[model samples]
Target chain A: MEKNNNHDRFFRELLSDSSREMPFSDFEDEVMAEIRMEYEKKFSGRRNIRLSWLFFILGMLSGIATVFVMSFYSANQPFAFISDNLLPVGIVFICLTIILFAEKLVKISFRRDNH
Target chain B: MDELYIKKVLDGDIDAFRYFVHQYKDKAYNLAFSVLKNEFDARDAVQEAYIIAFRKLGKFRGRSKFSTWFFRIVINEALKSSKKAGKEKYIADTRTESVDPGHVEINDIVSRDQQKYYIDLAMQNIPSKEALALTLFYIEEYSVEEIREITGWTESNTKVLLHRARKSMYHELNVLLSTEKKTLY
Candidate 1:
């Protein structure tokens, strides 16, 4: 208790205007303005990071379109000559391939909740 | 109203530059003064921060609070100034306050002015990062997380720096005050 009291008293006195000086006035505005200016000077050198978002969206859109086109093509395929005696098996295989690929695509793209 | 004027500047209202200076110049100046400890250096650092902030205002997406973003700029500017000039310290200006031990009542001797001077003196002697952390934490009363965010340091790093700074100040002041009392007796 005594130790804590002394520590508190010490800070109260240390920050006392009698011993320590307030550095300067209106510190926020003056220094912040200067920093703003410096940021401006450096602006021309580097591009902002948000620009990458456009590329990310575009990539996602392209992948989605490709999957849709592939699925549609598979759905329309005639199984007469190719499937022969194993038509049901061939259709099932195609469906399973698309399902597996879709899972893979989503997993590889966003990478969310991998655990 | 000031924020609106600043918005105008961001919108390319060149004349609003005057109000920009009015709004933030002194605040920036004082912060730099506290960090750099040299009046002229502080003045230049603040001026530099203003110019940088003004030029970069357009790119500000308002994701963070304006004051927080502005402080980031001010801190960078101060650090740069310190690096270049190596921090010229202790300007005993007109406001020089020498707290004689006699001023405070005897009952709270530890909290008295003279003891505080010893603490302050110890603080002044530490590395800049430790001093900066102490000031930002205790004087500014910022939370540890806030200090980490503002200083761009990890939470552990902030805690360690603050702990070390406080410990050093404790030891330094204890020795100083003991010697002071010895002389007096």
Candidate 2:
């Protein structure tokens, strides 16, 4: 028991008296650089989502404006013909818009999971 | 002071985290070095731990001191680094490094350095968990309660590990000294 106590004291004193200085001088800088990279990654993911939404909205607006102009200019064409062609185009536009929004949602969820 | 840095970090100022890294780097590195036993591996572990802490900064609830929380991360990272590095063979190698203390006289200059080297070697011979507990206890002067908080071990378990560590350390030193004695005789 006495030997054990002595050993403990000796080791404790040795360890406690050892220098506690950091070996790497640039540790802080490396960590901060990593944090900055993470921030940039998150920011870029958000920006991609925003840009996708912006493009989707713009496409939908332009599609609507084209339909309105075609309706006004093509008064001589049969209303049924116009509806048959323009109806599929409008539906496709709406589906594309919904798909774009869903893609954005999926991307955001994936980014969240990765982080 | 850490709280101030945390708040600023949350406020989107990345530079504020520099203060926290500066404050805890040495202790973090020490704990990692004690566990990993290789300076290069320890540095890598500390770097990885700091990044982990930074990414998870928002989850810190301030119930414990930031240093305590951060140290826990450092310990985990160091353990992972050790495992990945296959450090068991390194420990065995240290044990086999035949020290003929019999040939050399212990003097003021040599005893201090020799004792330090032997103690470190003895620590590596023990289980890593116990060595970690001992490091925190002796080097950091942490209480059993603080060790429990950092290691996530139960209070009784912490005490048991500490007890076992001291015993193992004593046995290791005896074995080393006995070898030297044999050489002398």
Candidate 3:
């Protein structure tokens, strides 16, 4: 048992002494550069998604407001046509929103799984 | 301290990751070298590991030390490179060659000032897995449980690997020293 302990201690000393530092002086810089590129790539992807959602929400809000205004001002000849088609327009808008939302959700889940 | 850096990195301070790189680089390189046994391959493995750790930094839940998680990445990256290079066969072949002190080459032993060179050469003769176990247990001073955690190996498996590693290291060092003595005479 003592002999085994001695051997272990000896090996430990030798191994510890043999421990080496990374020889590359710029190793940290190289790794950090790669990491920075990856970070930018990931964040840029997220930013693009956010921007797309912003545009989609803005477009949806404007479409709804236009429909609401036209329905209220139905007495005008130009909006009378819109007022008659308001139900179909609302349904189409709702469907589009749902489809876009579902698409975004699927994309997000796929991204999460990939990561 | 590591937590602080992790938080900084998570907060989008990309430069904060440099702290981890500087801190763990040497040890990670040593571990990589132990597994791959080729300096360039080990370096590439370490770089790839760091890149992976950075990409997955957001997923770090802090259940363990960052070093532990990072070391696991390093080991996995090294193992992957080792597999790709088909160095598993190299390790197995070395394992089958008996350590014959009589056949020890005088040119293989270095002067006292180059003891580390001699030790590294000795390490090259052992199985990579055994070398990795020895490096984690002896050089890094990690406990067997920590090793198991880092390596995802069972406790008994880690213990057995450490035992075999020590035996191989001892025999290899004996052969080296015997060669040195023969040269002296």
DockQ of each model vs. true complex: 0.06, 0.42, 0.49
2 or 3, greater by lDDT: 3
- Candidate 3 lDDT over B1-185, as tens digits, reads 99999899888899999999999999999999999998899999999999899888879899999999999999999999998988963433243234432343423556555677777887898888899998998889999899998999999999888777766765677767777788778
Report the C-alpha lDDT of model 1 over B24-122, residue by residue, as the tens digit.
555555456556756677677767776666667766677766655676787789888887877634322322133322333333345455555655566
**How far off is residue B26 in model 1, in Å?**
5.9
**What TM-score against the true fold does each predicted structure earn?**
0.53, 0.76, 0.75
User: TM-score for the first chain of model 1?
Assistant: 0.30
lDDT of each: 0.59, 0.75, 0.81
First chain TM-score in every candidate?
A: 0.30, 0.54, 0.55
Clashing pairs in 3: none
**Tens digit per residue, CA lDDT, model 2, B67-101:** 99999999999888778877743233233333233
Clashing pairs in 2: none
- Most accurate candidate by DockQ: 3
Q: Report iRMS values in order.
A: 9.0, 3.1, 2.3
Residue B86 of model 2 has an lDDT of 71
**Which candidate wins on lDDT?**
3
The TM-scores that each candidate's chain B achieves against the reference are: 0.72, 0.83, 0.84
